[model samples]
Target: MRTIPLITVSLLALAVLAAAGCNRQPTPTTGGEAKAPPAAATEAPRLDEHSYAEPDKVKTKDIALELNVDFDKKELSGSATYTLDWLDPKWGKLVLDTRDISIDKVVGERADGNWRDLTYVLAPTPDKILGTKLTIAAPERNKRIRITYHTSPNASGLQWLTPEMTEGKKTPFMFSQSQQIHARSWVPLQDTTMVRFTYTAHVTSPKDVMVLMSADNDPKAVRDGDYSFTMPQAIPSYLLAIAAGDLVFKPTGPRSGVWAEPAMAPKAANEFSDTEKMMETAEKLYGPYRWGRYDILVLPPSFPYGGMENPRLTFATPTAITGDKSLVSLIAHELSHSWSGNLVTFARARDAWLNEGFTTYVEMRIVEDLYGKERADMEKIVARNELKKEFTDANRDLQPLAVKEGVLKDPDDNLTGTVYTKGAWFAEFLENRFGREAFDAFLRGYFDHFAFQSITTEQFADYAKANLLDKYPGKVTQAEFDAWLHEPGIPATAPQVTSARFDAVDAVRKAYLDAGTLPTAATTSKWTTYEYVHFIEGLPEVMKPEQLAQIDGVFHFTGTPNGEIAQRWYPLAVRSGYTQANPAIAEFLTRIGRRKLIMPTYSALVKTPQGLQMAEQVFAKAKPGYHPITSGSVAQVIADAKSGKTQ
Candidate 1:
């Protein structure tokens, strides 16, 4: 995480993402014959479409860049030029998206290296880069291409690096996150998730600067005593990163190292001791850690997200050191990504569950092995409740996990417990059905097969179907994956307790309640969940609502009421006896918020103006010891409601 001071990206950022045109390059083939595609067919092509086709391997892509970074000011100033091969051969327009930026320079040319005759320069505006009627002509499918450009740091994540693990004068510290800021403003590429690439980023920083790409660092060379490093892997354009800062290194665990600010390297080594364990567990489970050395450098606050898994060197949030290794699961999660998310890129952002879920899945298993199952389970319960609350409160219904890659409205939406928890459950389901032997085998196999490759949700599903269900007896089906991945709903389940010998499920419920473990009350089968609010709201709708209420009430008859169940059952206890379930509701209301009636999903709960006002007042007035999620959700509700309010 290179700490970049937010300043102006002085000129040179002339990437007109708003508009771009396709220019083609001809390449020699097996027959040694070479030709360029027709100009009409290779006209302006969509950035994403140019990369994705019905195939497994990617062809070589040539991109040239020119950036001018101010050594004294820590500012990046430059513009970019590009030439792309057209697969579709559609003479449309070239467009790029930039945020909080302006195009300061322009240069476009076709493969022939001529300015106006071969290619055309487009318009770079506040929104897009458009050229009047520029058309690209090329062959139908495969063709060699070249794009050249010049730009400077005008965005959030652009960074300059040195070898000393520290910030400095020439390359103070810089890294770019194009998600919130614009990546295209600094470098030139096919800036969409739709197009995954194996790129060779020939970054020309200061002669004394050391640049780190999101691939394995091959070796460092000095041109006229200036530092340069070549990256050794193919990664997505989004995953493409550059860390230019004063860096210091601590080596460990066979090629694993930590690159930190020169001032922070020693402290980072002492603090990141857990990384050794994280790596061992991660390596044991996933395939061999690919990135030659794993290094983490701290970055500024605006460099959002827990960490950016840039191959071996991960960019981390400085806040990760809560002074405890307890939170280091983030380390494991990111490291685990060496295989799951990084190696096999997600088809789209909506299928983000694949990234997060696989990370979380490996994280739990790693933590359980490193720490214990009890701690893992405790974390699971906490995550479950948090996720449950978010899904319940938010207006946006859950989208299928296998969604096309893109951002959800609230970036937070993707990390919802629905994705993490249920997504973990999806992994757990695989492990339970296939056994760890087969499960790990499949994970390793999948990664090995698709390393540095792109895949679709269907392709991953196809892999699962071919490897698991097709081989196992009564294994999980594509239908199950479809239902969970495509459809959004709380997993429909409840405390199922039905058997040939049992007369009533109440006895089983009692047994389950008495014992902390789920009762083996029924024959082995699937499970369902009980959303307490809906059941309480439509009391008469259940198979036996009153009995269900009474049965729930018994759990709250007497207890400390501090645990998750007591917090809920106490309210049901109050409701059961008086109406259907009396004691539980009363206790919760009286002890929690007597005036605040339980509402449908806490999200909708505070939508009313009055509700939000009351909530804000209560939140501010409430004791500080209360749960953070409870307080945060209430605050979010109040804020959304007030912002949505006319006044």
Candidate 2:
């Protein structure tokens, strides 16, 4: 998963960009941006802090599963059969991580081709967040064990949707979000990124629904109730995904397609038409597309996250289908994951930058190749601003590119701007320091060297010392590399990314702020979402109702069809007490569940007394439809407001 940080501003407090120089004519700078003194650096956590399964003792090598999807009960009753590789010859038990799952029985495959019952224990959960430990007595000679179980109605990983929650409101839908250790809620496994396994699944759903997985898929396949899929390459447990719905498919290219509800299939196919070109560009930059076929499943509005790169099939939010191709960069981001995240994996959650940062860097390269350098620079500028805010406002301990041991209580904590934006900034720093050609060559070699493997930050550092830093003489020192990895806040020596188009946008914003001049369509008509976000971010924190009304009159932001622009503009409306955007905000909250877009708006709303009341009113109706991942976050925002814990 890739994280896009939320930029929430306070109505009563001054905005950072505006307070810096609202009236000063803005100019793009071309050097490293300075920041506050950095906190002491810490070593990367050696252990996967979020998992209880010790893969070093006995690891899961392969899995075969048979599951039955029960929409009425909102549960999945299945049997997971695992083929294990006992690294410890004397190991007596196979312990797996599970959450809210009722175990029916455990059976072991005997050497005589017969199955015998095995005694098992569901140990008391050490941490409620980590769930229970399923320990089974496995004979040293036996290599296979099967557990028949059913998921809880409140399983954190699975979301069962009623027909009404979908675009084509005729059939029920179901999907899984397993990232950050939630996979245990549905399937018992060694739920750690350090463990990789090949899997084959036989899943049965309602006759009217279609099923797809993170495996080779046929867009033209018939919608039968039973579906069997196989993923030949070994992958971490989080990449395990399944979606069943009333969906239709449309081919975007010879090897790429789109899966969406009938009403959305065409729009999604059109929006992501450039996906094949992006894949080709990435292949040229790195290596071949190892996933065989690249397809996108444009999930319903309730799908949480911007996109989940689930191997061959990427689960994406419908928000990306913005009619225009402006949002295709998200497609590029997910496609790049085939090389960075899926092919070469991160061993632990703290080393998530290995997955997300590399993917983000590759995503930018693809965008620059497919689109233009200016567009890529605009994105880099957006990320740079987000990272700058993280330095000033985020927790110091969580500000490092590599999080320390035991600092993370939940795996989701790894999805911070420090891991995504700051990590990408470091990559940008390297490319700038050692010429782009050298850095590109290094990346290509790095991926090829570690293909189909999971590695830690320490391993990456050792590899980089040998291959990149050693190869490029005096470009960067070990101290600088370590500081970039472990230190809090970006180093003052980091490269600064500037965008010329954004400088022009800032000049327009300064003119509006200084002379009360209204922006004309002639100067703003061709602006993309990046310009809109920058202009909105530079606006005065507090504005008169008429001032906001005048801007809304020109931009019609409240009713804009673009979700990215709506996310940036809604908070401004809330802070300025512009009641006209209230209906649209409520509609957006109810219609979409992407946390990156909604969290900031909700945070902004809770700061004001009136906005808090409205937020509560809208959330009361919208909360039930949201995925567990998203609802948990928004619920915390609302709870913080009620407890006067707004930060």
Candidate 3:
């Protein structure tokens, strides 16, 4: 989900233009007079306006972190030493973003190898979105500042799970989801996507547990609970991730592997057996896989998102481990982010479409290459349906893909299919307008030029105009582009995707609805998860119990191992008042903490009085296992229902 808030700033707008490799030349006079450039044309120092950090004043270049993981206290105590570069010596102080964290001390390293304590303050002006601004004052002579701090129990970024919360029920697990602005809650740094820094970490954890970060991770090495990691490639703070648990690794390929609980390791490895091929396919489309090895850590069921594209290692949810390869498209999607997001990112939360949209488009391409055009089309069709639903139901105040004005109260609200589905359709629109071969070249060049930098939507629009649209003159008009990017809803020119597989599924759905034809195993024995989802989602919202039973008897969806299908089926059963499915619904809700699955099921249940009571009971039992990110939203769902508000 899109986490954090939107704080529009002039610095953030202009910085991304340069970061995206847009070269602005001084305009020459009409009469051949070479006049001096306008004063306003002078570039502003790149700062993440959305972030509480004043990076333009004092920037972070690299970080050296020494930390100990205290599982007992559910805290990470660490000293984060930042190698900084001062842009203005007179600024007097460096500001960073901090959430629920305790600052022990702040010290600066002098040129003569002397360390002195620096006066730092957690600002009295605390913000719900930006967190607290940590201001440190010290002499400009010291280019290095180290902050000793520890995460508080209230740190929303870190989820501490008990042994009983895990699959094996033998060891506890802790993982940090630091996207957008949550990084500050764990470690004091520039918690914006705008700042890029290389980092080396020395981590101490329990001897029985293994730790991994978004860096060069060694699966086979755990030296007496002390582990060291390095990420040479500079990355945005949002991608800085860490996880520790009793984990084991199983190699899927020479350069690809799976990390999960010992019991889940082999299953996850086999499930993502195509990881190496996905990397190879993505590289062929974009460029070489820059991060030496591409691996995946199958996180616990509670990992909110389907997958987080954390540089070398992608943190994935175990939900994707369906025995069939149908769900590996999520892996493909994350792999594509290696080029679109990990290598390059959005300058601010406002332009999140640049990261997600591009990745979604690339994911479709990779899926098409490996699977088939039909499979890719089916994915797009599902996404398009989701986008239409979101567009119709979205709060009108919220901006669309390319938000132009107004600050987002919470960036996580922007985590709609608009960014993923509409964004992909927009890319598809561009590809259709400017031939596939040309678009391919443009994408490869775009990534190569802006590698490891944060860019804005404006920069991307300008780059497209110069590289693609300019060549084709009036083929695509600027107004059309504006409508696609800056408008508040789906554009009329959006690509329309269709799938024959879904067509067949829809026909079957109609047959069931019209003539009460119960589909047997033979009818859908060859169907993929996508087709199953389409068929299940197409079922009538209010179905007779006997009809639901007949369908459930044939499909056994309640007992299905596929999370995707089960997520849809259980919600429908609840809305239809199929009490027999309640036990399975409760089990599903308690076991899976993915927001995508949890929210819909609970939301559907809360629509009726009885269902709302059921939802509350299940949530009470399940809340402890969910990450804050999921539980926070689920709590609101119940609260809204109690107040007679629509979801």
The prediction achieving the highest lDDT against the true structure is: 2
- lDDT string for model 3 (1-647, tens) is 10111222233322332232211222222232223334446434435555767666777999999999998999999899999988876655566888877888778887888887665445444577777766565545368999888888768899999999887899899998998688988998888887899999999998888899999998678536899999999999989999999888899899989989989999999999988988888888899999988889998899988899998899999989888888899999999999999888988887888888999999999999999999999888877776656665456444377775445657677756767877888899999988899889999999998999999988998998988889788768999988887777778887677787888899888988898887677878899999988888777777887888988877888877788888788888887878898888889999899989778889899999999999899989988889888988899999999998965
**lDDT (10s digit) by residue, model 2, range 317-370:** 998877778888899999989999899998888889999898898999999998
Q: In terms of TM-score, how similar is model 1 to the real structure? A: 0.61
Each model's C-alpha lDDT? 0.49, 0.82, 0.82
Per-residue accuracy of model 1 over 54-93 as CA lDDT, tens digit each: 1122222444344444545545544444434444344222
Estimate the lDDT of model 2: 0.82
TM-score of 3: 0.91
Question: With candidate 1 superimposed using the best TM-score fit, by how many Å does residue 480's alpha carbon deviate from the native?
Answer: 2.9
TM agreement with the true structure for every prediction? 0.61, 0.91, 0.91
In model 3, state the lDDT of residue 630: 90
RMSD of each: 13.2, 14.1, 9.6
Error of 2 at 308 (Å): 0.3
Question: Which 10-residue span in candidate 2 carries the lowest summed lDDT?
Answer: 21-30
